[model samples]
Target: MPQIMQMGEHAVIGLDGLEALLAGLKRRDYRLIGPTLRDQAIVYDDIGGTADLPQGFGDEQDGGRYRLVRRGDARLFGYAVGPQSWKHYLHPPMLSLWRAERHGQSFDIIESEEILPRFAFLGVRACELNAIALQDRVFLGDEYVDLHYRRRRDGAFIVAVNCSHAGGTCFCVSMKTGPKVAAGFDLALTEVLVGDAHSFVVEIGSAEGAELLAELPARKASAEDLAAAAAIVAGTAANMGRDMETEGLQDLLARNLDHKLWDDVAQRCLTCANCTMVCPTCFCTSVEDASDLAAETAERKRRWDSCFTMDFSHLPGGSVRNSAKSRYRQWMTHKLSTWFDQFGTSGCVGCGRCITWCPVGIDITEEVRAIRDDAPK
Candidate 1:
């Protein structure tokens, strides 16, 4: 339910008010999860408050390279996407499914009773919002619903942050996914820093967001404040670090199944699955059942898997896609081309984790261009 008058309204809040927003969510029993500096990289973890945010920190990311740098400004949420995404929380890498105890004649099955977190994701980016939505179609679809994901997702509150600056590998603008957050958030923020004025221009997206704003000390956004926020997003869009020609991209790849570029890229690929591991929309998993020596008790667990692994395509007799070329093609085509056939949208939101985190610097955008460049006339 929306407080019709408050929904879509914009307000400005200073740093102190931003801290209060976190405290308010905490008072509502929501565990704070956001980015923080750890081990020389900005990583998402439990945040106590605004202090845990990566203030005055920015990142330099290119294919196969990432480094943290000081921004010299006390601006929180100033960095680009890190190696991890919100999927790490919503759809965990590993989860226990069930357990069984054998008692001679029959086995008793015990369902997993792990407690789910009521999360308030503090600094979600626009591209990430798209990633989360795509995942919802996978886990909460009409055909089959993952109860574990549903429970966690239902209780989560999203605080989206429009990108103040783009990353070296970013192409969310080309993907039509970002620079500015369009939808799918409880509250959206645009960090505005002009001269001595450092504040967040907040956009209320729901009744809950409106109620939360009521608790915070904020003022109505002025036309100049809103324009400044718009300018920042527009600047980010103009200087996008990368771009891909997506027109008929699905058809382009569908026509190049035998392209030599696949072989060339595969030769450089380690089949390490680093790209899939960091991809926010990737949902593949492998289930394992473990037992003790006597086999009296057993547990079933599900963990993230990747198409890059030979075992991922294994069938009854042997692996289906045995060659590295085949595996690499499967991943890229599925993400950029075949995903639309299955999910009605692209799997990639162009956050570029796959590009930046790849050990061998294989850029997905470059690969797409290579295919387009060599397509049969």
Candidate 2:
């Protein structure tokens, strides 16, 4: 029941046309990775077509609470983020650096080489895009770039989705990273469902996207279709679930190093490193060497680590951050304040993953509000 009105650069496609898009990407030798329902949660994984998407499914998210619910409509991109992010795909949790094998007296070092896949990411949100950009600075900005991360990032294609429904913990609007995608996408889509008519307004952001669209059955978008898409984005922007006061936040944390707010947060924090693990911007890691009993072979491996661990701050004498209060203080200060000195931007993207996935439901926004309220007047 799709109508083809005209022909142009921008177009509108019915929900059924999604398969054509997926097929087009596959024909180009790109592996399509998208959102799907797995283990009672929406996760990013390899998908085949529209049938693999989490259709008619939505999620309810709040501080330390998350539940999957029926949306009553077959909306493809209706849910917010789950526990997983694109980070799991780009930067692996455990990476083998190299292996050594004994050949007579000397040992031969064998480097770890992996075959990087060409991936096309579907349903990428605006805040997630910002997170990926921030990670780019961490892995590829300097001379000592991570070759593995660079290969995956450079070959991946992004298809961003403009949010129409905001989650209970969502605050991307306050961080100016969401509701409407500004950049970092090959193609952007806004889902528009009105009166039993489900369609999408697609905007091409790259030559590759344009070529792909040309291969699909689509029509030039009309004025009414454009208006409907704009209104959906506007309404989503107006209904933000939480807000963070970023004005002078950097200086506030830097000056309040000895503030009592740290103690209050430490009492509730488990120091379990859930925040750092779920965080899309945290890049801390640890390396280790493993060898056999005969010492005939050895392997070097790198894995994700967190500041909450005692050994994370190990020095010549002892660990620097001994108490939970000191560890919590260091984490918050680095994320909101000192991160600017190191990366020129805040470490948080307002994605609310940390707030939703925390075991005790410790809200970062609430913590910041408490500190701001108790500051010297």
Please tell me which predicted candidate would have the highest lDDT against the true structure. 1
**Candidate 1 wrongly placed segments (more than 4 Å):** 1-5
What's the lDDT for residue 72 in model 1? 77
Q: Give per-residue CA lDDT, model 2, range 193-241, as digits (tens).
A: 8769988899887877877777777888889888999999999888877
Q: Could you give candidate 1's per-residue lDDT for residues 1-377 as a string of tens digits? A: 12233888899899988999999999999989999999999999999988889989999999999999999787898899998999898999999999999999899999999787699998899999999999999999867899989988997998999999899999999899998998889999999887788899999998899899888888888898899999999998998888999999999999999999999997999999999999999999999999999989999999999999989999999999999899999999999999999999999999999999999999999999988988986
| Model 1 poorest 10 in a row by lDDT | 1-10
RMSD vs true structure, all candidates: 1.8, 2.6
Per-model TM-score versus the true fold: 0.97, 0.96
Q: Please give the CA lDDT of all the candidate structures.
A: 0.92, 0.88
For residue 274, what is the lDDT in candidate 2?
90
Q: Candidate 2: where is the Cα deviation over 4 Å?
A: 1-9
Count of backbone collisions within predicted model 1: 0
